[model samples]
Target: MTSLSVLNSALLVLSVALVLLHVSATRAKPNKARTLFAIFCGSIAFLMCKQLSAASIGPYQFLIGIGASATCNAYWLFSRVFFRRRDAIKPQHLYVAVAIALLVAMNQIYMFLKGMAVFTPAPDALVRYILVELTLLLSSCILVLTFWEGCRGFGKDTFEGKAQRILFLSVFVFALAGSKIAKGLLADNPQALEYIISAITLLVMVSTQILLMWRYTNHLDFLTTIPLRERLQPSAATDATKATDSRGELSPLARQIRDLIIGQAQYLQENLKVSDIARELDAPEYLISKAIRTELGAANFNQYVNTLRIAHAQTLLADPDHLKTSILAIGLDSGFASVGPFTRAFKTKTGLTPSEYRQNLQAK
Candidate 1:
């Protein structure tokens, strides 16, 4: 086998190994993120196998080609599941992915038939051109959407979460997109140059896998999702207390955070951010985040802040004096940017809508 083939084979093995690792981890933790990540890894393996079988024509090659065509879709779905705080992969997501895969597969089959002289058409045939262009257009759109997903709510993410997002966008998204564009531009280049490009792309993939493994082992929270309520429950509080002392006193930094947000009511400031609190306290953002996680039993800075905001809103919602106050007014006074997120966060925390909570309070 040629050197490019050998490298492709090695990458295929590594990609399959990653799939197995994610699968095993999912079995242990029952995480949707890990399962979707495993699917993404499986798609990468299929792409490598498709490249390895480029010279062969058979049913296996056709199936590999179809799987390879779904790589962008798989990555997009994985990104949505991983980075979006509340979004999950719905049935429509799968339907769209499958539809795109079928379109790309049909385009590939058309090209294969034309190459075999089974059908002849003009080089500029409208039908063939449209199919090819549509395939590329959809793939490009999906890649852009994936990048957007990684960037959504970036400012609110913890420091480690931000780093993981940057790593994924840089290594996986940019590398793969750049390689595809370069391959198209250099289609007529020397075979050796193509092999060199392939080698670099595979090396980037290896780097991505290594970084992901490191993050998985050392910072698993960045890769997994835990419910906000679970993070804030009494059990988590007990664990945090145990980490500190028998007295269950808050750490010094945690005390300062509480003093500012609770005592000073800084959470009443709209668009409150960890960086703003860090600046106020003259501390680093990561340190502030760590204090909240370890001492306050919050999943992140936003959750901690939202918990405070919701609690404050609950007081207003339960007060007969504030009965004249609209829910929007109360949400604004409680520091929410708008009523939508305020309502959502309130519901997640209190298990009732703001209106429902108020109605229940009045009924009591």
Candidate 2:
């Protein structure tokens, strides 16, 4: 039989490798979330080393400079970076990340100092239990905050899809936490039971990593070039369901919205609003919402606008007549605030830098 400690060590090692694999794959020009995720993975690896060692044959309850709060914050920050738009990852986000992790680190450091200063003869068991509970509460609160924002920001009207996924995660997390609490109630049981619980924790962590990767690839990373309307509306559906109004052959409302934005260059406005569009068209807010999101199949308004900007930039880059135009100028002309975001967005859509794209056009 495999020893629990050895199993934990193996699992932790596997998880570390997976995290490192993702970081390496995206490192050429690492995204903001990718960098933050790397830091989180590194911290978790260090903690796992200490915990696995203590369980198997190392020091007793040694501190590893990271704890529950740090891991929880890492999870939250990863979600933020992964879902937010390319330009959304700003300096303030870095400050916020540092602030959250620093708060937990400071508390731990202060407690460690206090312990050294007031070495009591007898260890306070109740105090330790209370501290554990507080840590769990803090971590749970952070998870709540992360989940709310993460699902909200995911494109494609994700309130139903992504939010449901987060709900599933919440159930899994609480169920695991409950199991631990139940195990603690079995204090009179054999010492080996503790090892079993640790093994379960290791399994849970591995499963979480797998779920995250699967979700990222399956839904978030799965790009589609087809028109959004076709994906949702099956070919076998009746023609009557197509709702052919004056909007156009595709979707009259959707086409109207697109034409107004494209022809008038409304996308050039950085702070465009759904309400504003609705008011201009004298349509109800939900009607316009349905036009863009349900009928058009855009992830959200921002994504729809980004598509226009990226497509426009592509045209400018590929135009032989505009051979002397600077990439930065094209990016700005296409509604991007700066060259960095413009480049990232362009690469994301076309899988090439503006220069490379231009060169390819010339070659063809």
Candidate 3:
């Protein structure tokens, strides 16, 4: 094998290993991020195998070709599943993936038939050109979407979360997109240049997987939002004791702030802000934020308030008396400005939509 083929072989092995690792790790827990990550890795593996032998023709190669073509789509979905707290993989997302896959498959089948001399196109035919442009357009849009997803909610993320987001945008989004643009611009370059570009791209991908594995093994919570139980149940104390213990963890000013919020149920105000809390407590806004972050272990004032709101919403969700109450009304009563943020936050914490959680309660 040539040196390029040997490098591709090594990358293929590494990519396949990462896929297996992600799949094995998620087998017992069924983590959506890890599962999607496995698919992303599999897509990389397919690309590497394609590079090793570009002219392979068979049913299996056709399927693998489709997968290699959907690399951008797979990474886009993986980014959404990784970064977004809400329902990331909606029905529309699946439809788009299927559509992209089908488009690529059609192009591949066209090429296969032409190569076998079973089909021919007119000299003026635009079918091939149109299909190629459409695929490129869709892939570019998906890349842009992936970057947007990585940027979304960045201001609200924890320090670790922000770092992970930045890392992904730098390593995967920019690197892959740059490689594609370079390849397109250099379409007539020698085959060796293509191999060099592919090697660099594969190296970047392998490095990303290594970093992700390190993050996963280190129990980094950046990949997902904090669970509701961890946010609420910090210890084994009873509710009354828990209240006292929670207050005890804070400084005197923080305790006073907590008392003012909890004692008067200020969290139900819906438009509550740190400035409002600071004004009521005769304290500075920065101090109030610091108290929440340091004493409450929250990423910010909003997270602290949302934790309380989600806890309250959980109570109302499980209440038999409020079984007939509208979810929107319950969410509003719990201090959410609107249903969208409320639903997203609730799902991030609890891994269930408001409706699903309520339904589960009813089932129980």
Structural similarity to truth (TM-score) of each candidate = 0.54, 0.45, 0.56
Ranking by TM-score: 3, 1, 2
lDDT of 2 by residue, 221-293 (tens): 2322333223222352223224332224455566557644553345655556787677656788787777766
lDDT against the true structure, per candidate, is 0.67, 0.57, 0.67
lDDT by residue for model 1 (31-126), tens: 444555566566666666765675665445655666656567866886776664332577988887887788878876776667667668876388
On TM-score, who's better, 1 or 2?
Answer: 1
TM-score attained by model 2: 0.45
Among all windows of 10 consecutive residues in model 2, the one with the lowest summed lDDT is: 223-232
Per-residue accuracy of model 3 over 19-124 as CA lDDT, tens digit each: 5646545653334556666676666666566555554453345445666655678768877766654456889998887777778888877766665666667752
Clashing pairs in 1: none
User: Which pairs clash in model 2?
Assistant: 156-299, 247-252, 248-252
Off by over 4 Å in 1: 1-26, 56-60, 112-118, 121-125, 172-181, 184-190, 196-217, 220-364
